[model samples]
Target chain A: MSQTSRPRSRSGNLAAEKLTYAAMLTPALLLLAVFVFIPVALVIYGSLFDFGLTSRDWTFVGLGNYVEAFGDDVFWIALRNNLIIVIGSIVLQVGFGTLLAAVLDRGVRLGRTLMRTIIFAPMVISSVAVGLIWLIILDPNVGPLNAVVKGVGLTPPKLGWLGDPSISIWVVLGIAAWQYTGFMMVLILAGLQAVPKDIYQAAALDGATGLRAFWYITLPSIRNILIVAILITTVGGFKVFDLIFVTTGGGPANSTQVLGTYIYLQAFNIGEMGFANAISVVLLLIAVGLGWLQLKTSRKA
Target chain B: MKVLGTACVVSLAALAIGMPAVAADKATVKFWTLKNPGMAEFAAEAIEAFKEKRPDIEVVYEDFPNEAYKTAIQVALNGSEPPDAFYNWVGEDSARLVREGLVMDVSEYGTEPDGFQSILSDGWLSTLQYDGKQYGVPLEAVSKFFYYNTNFFAEHELKVPDSFDGLLQSCRDIRAIDEDIVPMPLGNSERWKLNHFITMLNERVVGHEAANPDYALEADDATLFTNPRYVEALQKVLDLQEAGCFQDAPNATSPELTRTMFATEASPMIYCGSWCAGIFNGEGFEDFKMFRMPEVKGGDGADGTNFLIVQGYQISAKSKYPEETVAWLSHLVSPEMAVRYAETMGRVPSNPASLDSSDQLTESFKWIAKDVSEITVPINVLDVKLENTVSEAYLDGGVELLNGTLTPEQVMEKVRETALKAKAKLDK
Candidate 1:
């Protein structure tokens, strides 16, 4: 009788522990299920149906939206623009961020704190605010930049900085670099400080100083942080919407259109829910794939 | 006995939660409108007057910015709690909503003596009609025209263009007189500005009767938007650009900034809406004159055909209190209130009776209303008439054309492709 009761009680205790764990996780799990997981599932499901936001009738067209998106020229243009932004961001944000971090970490001792604050100032400002600031500065008719250009006896471009379609994407890149480089710098700066001082001193004694020391000693130490920064930028580039929205609105003939804005136009402006969802799915896949690749590379490194 | 008592208590609590905790006597009507200058003040003044008539009906008003309002209204209508009535452009947008059974037909209330049918004309009411049923109350009549600086025209000895060729010549002459001045300042960055130009040009080239079927996408697929005249209208926009009528970067300028340029006398002329008269007056630039688009020589367009769009309130089909909603919307468009709308908003009221009632109406506003009334065929703006996707394509095409990135043929090709796809989707 004692042996049978002992085993039963142990099983009962295991069940109670399981119940407690579920109860503890219920709030957070429920929130994720309601807000994030449900919306993602709905998007995936909606991508297969042709419907509008207000349409009472929904027609299931399996893979039709994806096929249409694949054929659409605007989709291709948007994808190309997204890749351009991603590559440009990695080069400018990561490349320049490392340089700034090194300078602040080793070279600039005087007023370092002040310079650091000033460089990092734009990160706290919202993207919409940053876009508006840049818009005013780049205004063709009455902007101060144009006034200065004219004052210096030079003709500003006829279409202004953002008006020219061929160069507008690069202008966006430059503005993004100005805003996000400091964030990357601060992130990298933390990793730089964590590096052991003895490793650098040993490398210097072995004649690996200055640029050589940075390449051999400092870079290898912060490898993980650099990978993290690149991954963040890569993911962020794919999701960029608000800045382009406020500044260009994907205009000057759709020259600045990225995937996010294109999806918005299809969904809200054109009322193509299924097509927009299909585009959203593609965007999600691209972001996820790039992220996975970055993680695998980081692990290999 | 204990279970029964607990059940009774729960039932009572549920009933109490469902009931309004307020006076429970007043009916709240949620009213929504696009944000415009002075609209809040105007709505407040109107609401104050409305309270005198129906103190029991409390109107909860909300305003949305123009860009977001289009999406917000549709999304709100789909939600469980929608506004009792909302503002809408009375064309394809309202027609789509009506077709989807999202708008309530207020015809019964509309026909009452004090309702909009009696206050507004039959033709005006027809603007908001789909399938022979009225779905909206027409509030304002808006039209676009060339707002030129009288001082600049007088200084340059430039006459108003009365023919298509004359308009082009006028542009050349303006550019010749002052190379620095833009002949017609266009803000196509918003795309609707170019749509306005194209809509009038379509009326000029194809005439209203021929353009209507195409505008409605009722024409056969092969012939749908295949008219050479449609391409010709697009060419004319490029012609204006080539003639140096517009600024160098029309595609980059905002409509508000362009309006400021004209009001400050920076630009000599701008094709602006009737509402701009109020803005010009407010900005203290009263020295302005207006003219319609010149006649397209050898085209099918007739005199007195002009661009006219009617905007008004639409009742939600899901409203709990349709009678009160209709009553509130009707009261807003009543003659007394229409006069206030015209006086304060600087728009021509749909109610003709409001015209002579408002002593505060500007001289320019009065003339514009008179001119709009004389138009035999009032063409709906292209953006409002065309399907959403096609309209977007047309808008984008206009930008590309202005930017010199796409030629007339190329723009038409792009428009045709999108129109075909949109028509296919609608058919499905």
Candidate 2:
């Protein structure tokens, strides 16, 4: 009788656990199904047809849109611009962010809190506001930058900051870095704070001092955090639209046309929904691949 | 429990009794327009007038910003609900909507002898027609004119240019007076501003008949956009840039900023739309004078071939109340409302009768309306008339052309490539 009762209680506990887990996961799975998977499925399916924004005509094109985008010069230019932005963001945002985090964590003692707050301020501001403020600062004719340049007995660039096709992208990248480096720094600073203090004592005992200690111990210890920072920057760069849209409008001869803006232009401006969807699918894949890399790296760490 | 159950039954009974009564009493028509400075007041006035005419029909008017209106209208039209009546350009935009079956014909209401067709001319009516079917009612017409600062011209001793060569000479003279001052401030960052110049240039150089084929891309693949004169027209724009007529960074500056420069006398001249008179008036810079674009040298284009764009209202095909929508639209555009439109908006009302009594039509605006009436070739705005793909290419080409990165020939080659692709798609 005791053995039978024990088996019955065990079975009852198992049933309750299974019910709890199922109940907990249903809402999350439903949300993912509704918000993410369904939309993605629609985008992937719709990409195979020639559809317009308002038009009900959906002609079966069978990858025609993708082929068209591949052949399209603007598409190529947008992809190239997106690549530039990704690389620039990694170099500027991650590199400077890590440096700032390190300095705040160990180097500066007097104004660490103030510097951290100031650096993190831009992250709080909306990208659109950032773009507007920068547009005025970069205006060729009336901007204070030009006034200052002239005041210093130097002529500004003939096309101003955002006017030159060759240099406008770099200006945009700089503006992006100005806004995002703080966010990355904050993220990395948290990681640095979580690092064990005993590691530094151990490194000093091993005669690895200052830069050598930072390189061998501090850098390796913050590897996961740096990867996180890079993953964020990479995804953010790919998804960049508002800043570029509000600033240069992907213009000066489509020189600043990135994938995000290009997708918008095709979908809304050009009324090519299928083509935009195809480009968006490619963008989604790149983001997913980057995300997978991040996950794999994090798992290894 | 009995009391609560009884209360619930009473509420359900009340709702059942009241629902149809509310639904039957009024037909609300959704109306959408791009947000402008005085448009809200003007729409309110029209709706007020409309209310007196049709008491049973309630109109809901919503305004969206110009940049967002394109996507808003498209999405609204495609979604479960669409505006009953909406603003649209009378060209490829509305034509595409009409083709998509998103726009109602409204032919009967528009062609009513006592309706909008009676007040508007056949030509204005035809602007909204596609495949011999009317899809819209032309409400207003806009045309480009050169707005020059009177004080600047007086101080510089510059006479109004009457020919293409004279215009270039005027630029040279103005630049020579003060090399620092921009002779003309053109903001092509939006791209449409430069496309305006190309539209007039194409007419001036390629003429209507010759350019029409290239514009329509009806020519053979090898001959598509091969017209040398088209390249020359682009060259003239480059020539103006070389003459220091335009700012160093026209491609980056905004159209609004360009207007401000001309208004503040920082720039001596700015070619803008007739709608700019209202802006100039609002900005308190009324000391500006209007002039048509000067004639192109050795060109077959007719004189006074102005760049005009007609904007109008289209009834959504899915509107539940077509009769009320049409009636409300007719009342909105009636002779009485037209006067109010002119007074409030300072636009050239579609109804010719509005010109007789409008007190708000400034002298400069009056001059534009008169000048537009004299247009022989009737050159429509390029962005409105061209296919979407080709229009984008033209816009980018204008940017590259002004940036001095692409030559006229190169620009035309790009244009040809886009035009060929667009033509193939359109043909299909």
Candidate 3:
């Protein structure tokens, strides 16, 4: 009699609880369906057609857009640029950010807060504004930089840093690093703070010292946080657009064009909405795939 | 609970009743324009005039910075609420909008005798037409020309260049005097500015070919980039850079910077459009003059033809009050209005009746007009596809050439490739 009564109560409770949970999550679920899921579904759908701003002249050309994208030289160039930016950020931002964070943690005797604020100030500025400011600073004629170069008693050959396609990539990478290094440093510093000082002391007692202690104790302790920072920077690097658009405009002749700006140009500028969406789908997949790998590797570690 | 429920019901009912009534009583047209020092004032005056004519209609004027105008317009047009009437860059931009049917067919209104100038001659009307129908009313016409600082020229005792050789020699003389001062500040950073140079060369090389009935037919049938004239025109730009005639870091230098340099006499000369006349006027440049860029050697019909680019206004297809918008546009395109616009903006009028010169006009303005009037060939309208493709390649390749990374042939090849792709896409 007792077991039958308990089962009856539990079944009734489960029904009420399910209703309560649905009611609580209804708004969020609706929002996700409208904003996120629907747009992604549309992107996937749109990639199958050859639609533009004008006319519903879409023909269902399965994988045609993808095939064309692969063959397109601009796509390859933009992809190459994206890879360069990703690798550059990882080497410069992550490596320098970690080293800087460790140095700062060791307690520099200088104005640490002031240094930190100065380093982080760029991240606080809008990317567009940052691009413009750099454009002015890098100007050959009126810019003080050239003036300094001339003041050094050398005939300064006017370098179109942004105009020259060969050098534009490096300039853009430099800008990305300048803006993001501080952000990465802050993340690393926070992770460093979370690291237990006792662990380092214990390692020292066990004959671990200097670089050895950092290698065995400090790095392993903060490995998860570094992974998190790396994942964030990698995704951020892939999605860079505003600075590139404002500074170089993917010029002097589409040389500095990134996938994000290239997608924008394809969709809005060229009115190739379907083709642009296909590129976006590819970008999204690459990002997701990379992020998944990072997470898996971190978890295994 | 009853009181709260009652308040919600009342508010919802109020909103429901208020919205349609507000929307119906007065038609509001959102207008976007580039920010200029005096444009807001002009827009305000125009709005007042519009309001006086149509008491029931209201205009919501929004202004954006010049640099942000393109992105802002694109976003605004695609947004939940779009402007009814907006400023647009002419040429490929207008064609894009017209093709999309985003722009309204004001043909019925524009063709009306009193709505717009009936005397819009075949050549004049052709500029605004897309696929045989007018999509917009031509607001202003501008021709690219060489603006020189009169004081600098006088100081250097250099005459205005009338031939290609003379132009090259003058550049060398200017360089010899002061290497720091750029003889011609051709800024390649803004790709369009680079295109200005290319357009001038095209005029010199192709001559009447751009306006030729046979030329368009030929272009439609085959790629225009493969043509000898196209490569010859591109070569002239590369030649100029190699000669060290242009400013250092041409790619990094923007139009604004170039203009500022000219205005301050830092650079002796700048190749810019006649729209810059107002800028010079505003800057109180008392000793600035302009002349036509010299003709290229052995170029066909390379005489007096000046390159004319037009910018205009169009009503959006999605506009709520199409009639009112048409009425406003009609008033703006009238002879009196065109003259006013020309005077204020320092632009040439498309209407024949409004071409009267004023005493306040600069010497360069008169010279350009006289030169254009005497030309046997009409101003060239570049094929939209070839224009963007070649322009971008020239800009990108121009920098590399200047930096010694790419040779002239490579630059031409890159341009040819882009032009071929654009032709293929356009042909489809």
Q: What is the C-alpha lDDT of each candidate?
A: 0.88, 0.87, 0.75
Q: Is candidate 1 or candidate 2 better by DockQ?
A: 2
* Top DockQ hit: 2
Q: Locate the minimum summed-lDDT window of 10 residues in model 1 chain B.
A: B17-26
Model 2 chain B is weakest, by summed lDDT over 10 consecutive residues, at B110-119
lDDT of 3 at A16: 94
Error of 1 at A181 (Å): 1.0
Of candidate 1 chain A, the 10-residue stretch with the lowest lDDT total is A292-301
Model 1 ranges with Cα > 4 A deviation: A1-18, A148-155, A291-301, B1-24
Q: State TM-scores per candidate.
A: 0.94, 0.96, 0.89
The TM-score that candidate 1 achieves is 0.94
What residue pairs clash in candidate 1, if any at all?
none
lDDT of 2 by residue, B385-420 (tens): 888888988999998888778899998888888998
Candidate 1, residue B304: CA error in Å? 0.5
**Candidate 2 deviant stretches above 4 angstroms:** A153-155, B1-7, B110-114
Fnat for the candidates in order: 0.62, 0.72, 0.57
Per-residue lDDT tens digits of candidate 3, residues B213-293? 322323543554455675677677767776668876777888898888888888788888777867877787858877777
How much is the lDDT of residue B354 in candidate 2?
Answer: 61
